[model samples]
Target: METVRTIDLLLDAFGRIPPLLADAVRGLDRAALLWRPEVDGRQGNSIGWLAWHLARQEDTQVAALVGGEEVWRAGGWHARSGVPYDEAAMGYGMTTDEVGRFDVTDGEVLIAYYDAVHARTVEVIARMSDADLARIVDRSWDPPVTAAVRLVSVVDDAAQHVGQAAYLRGLLGGPEAD
Candidate 1:
């Protein structure tokens, strides 16, 4: 595939996916939000947990990509000394099984929060010089991936999970699957 602008890729992913996923969960009643499908025999994460997890993962990985290595290295990021970080990390929480249980049940807030995070990521990428992009850094256990790799991984993970969330929503009788 031809190389594309990172900003283009990021925006495209966000624009195409979030709405569909959000729509999938829109109008869901409480039980629906907490609905768990038995896929191969196990209960899947609830919409609330999924949303919280997605936001946490994205915020953490994005911070890492931009040089904030320890932003979310531990569970403490979600604890007392960590509420601020956790709030930034997710926008949701771990205890809640589905989106309906979150402090902000409005899908719009979740969508907007994700957009803001993506915008910050883009800004960070833009600020990186070519050298910075090519520079290798150890951000995880699987050896060092370049700044570029981390950046792409962050976007890819977000998109993949958004799709997952949408799928879960569909399984729960969301609009997309109806």
Candidate 2:
């Protein structure tokens, strides 16, 4: 039996996220994309916010690994998104108010941004070598983090957010959801 290369496995896992994200926001209007289950609570995230965060996360992490510029900046997504936030904000450590402030309401734009970031991720993964994967990318952790581990973490985080987006879509009762 031929063992699958690690890069192939990572690529396969990463490939699944974008389509799920697309389906989650498909056919959703601006209201639906921005809807939150609780107007005064922090129990849920809007579909638009979740999609943006996930794309930013993947874009930043993968760009760091590959030593390339993020698609958010290089692809002119900030201006195109008209998100009213800085280019560097990736939804990490964001307060409830800040999350609420993310006002990207166009589902098509959100999906397009995600698709662009995902394409960059796929390109980086395709070009990674065994040595690159084994190289340590971060040393702040106790055991240190390798490129392979960082890639896996990125994929895992993306999968969770995409799943959350899909759940929100179902909760909001979209036509193409569920």
Candidate 3:
């Protein structure tokens, strides 16, 4: 049996995310999408915020790997969604107040942005060679981050956020995607 190349594996993993994300976002009413659960003085993220963060992180990371523009700004998502384009804030290290202030209540916008980022992710991987994947993208950590590592990190983050959104959807009794 032929072993799957790392590129193929990465493509397959990224391909699986959109449907899961769609299910998590679909049929969610404004209330469900924007609902922030709180327990013991800690606030939980809403489904909308999860989706938004996933897309933003993926967009930022993948763009960095490809040495290009993020889909969020290049694709005019920020303008279309009425959210300010903050290149520095890719939904990482956001304080509780900042998370609470994320006000994209429309599921359609959230899903659309995620879809756009997914498209860009696939394209970037398709255009990459083996050497590109092995190249170091960041050296901030003790172990410098490679393109392959960054891609995996992006997918891992997206999967976790997708699961959180789905859990929130189920708790709110949101309908399944049609």
Candidate 4:
């Protein structure tokens, strides 16, 4: 709820969950979790896929920033996640078929993975000084990215994805939201 300071802003942005993602995930059957709306013969992203992607993105980014192993691999989530293998795979450039192949049955697993990533991110940020936050961690851009910017990027990306997941959850109705 505190968004005044930089760290608080990141936490507030990431922890902002008015939509209640756990409600979108918990108690939902596999069919409901993986349902993608078919529109004009194109299938949209599923709630499960969005959550999985968000977790992967956050896990990879936070781990890289901290120079630590990804919670996905470290926590053995890669083995548990039924998706196909790619050491760097975080749902980026995944084909529609690949997205469809994401066969995570239990929502609890996704929730747990996300929770671990969130915890690690919080831990890392909590210990960082203002100088640490200002340190350049990425150099791909004209102006290198700082730890603070990177963390905000993670928060921004996660918010969009989780918001999409929530939207997909809302779209499920009739026999679908089962």
Best by TM-score: 2
What's the lDDT for candidate 4? Answer: 0.81
**lDDT of each residue in 24-137, candidate 3, tens digit only:** 887777777778889899998988888889998899889877779989888878866654436456778888788887766478888899899998899999888889999998
* Candidate 1 accuracy as TM-score: 0.65
Please give each candidate's TM-score: 0.65, 0.94, 0.92, 0.89
Q: Sort all candidates by TM-score, best to worst.
A: 2, 3, 4, 1
Query: Candidate 2 has which clashing residue pairs, if any?
Result: none
* Tens-place lDDT digits, model 1, residues 51-94: 54565677677676665643334333344221223345454344
How much is 74 displaced in model 2, in angstroms? 0.5
Best by lDDT: 2
lDDT of each: 0.57, 0.88, 0.84, 0.81
The deviation in Å at residue 20 for candidate 2 is 0.2
How many clashes show up in model 4? 0
* Error of model 4, residue 145, in angstroms: 1.2
Q: Would you give me the overall lDDT of model 2?
A: 0.88
Count the clashes in each prediction.
Answer: 2, 0, 0, 0
How many angstroms is residue 83 displaced in model 2 relative to the true structure, after the best TM-score fit? Answer: 1.1
lDDT of 2 by residue, 107-151 (tens): 898999999998888888899899999999999997999999999
**lDDT digits (tens) for residues 8-71 of candidate 4:** 7677676764225565677778888788888899888888888888999999999999889999
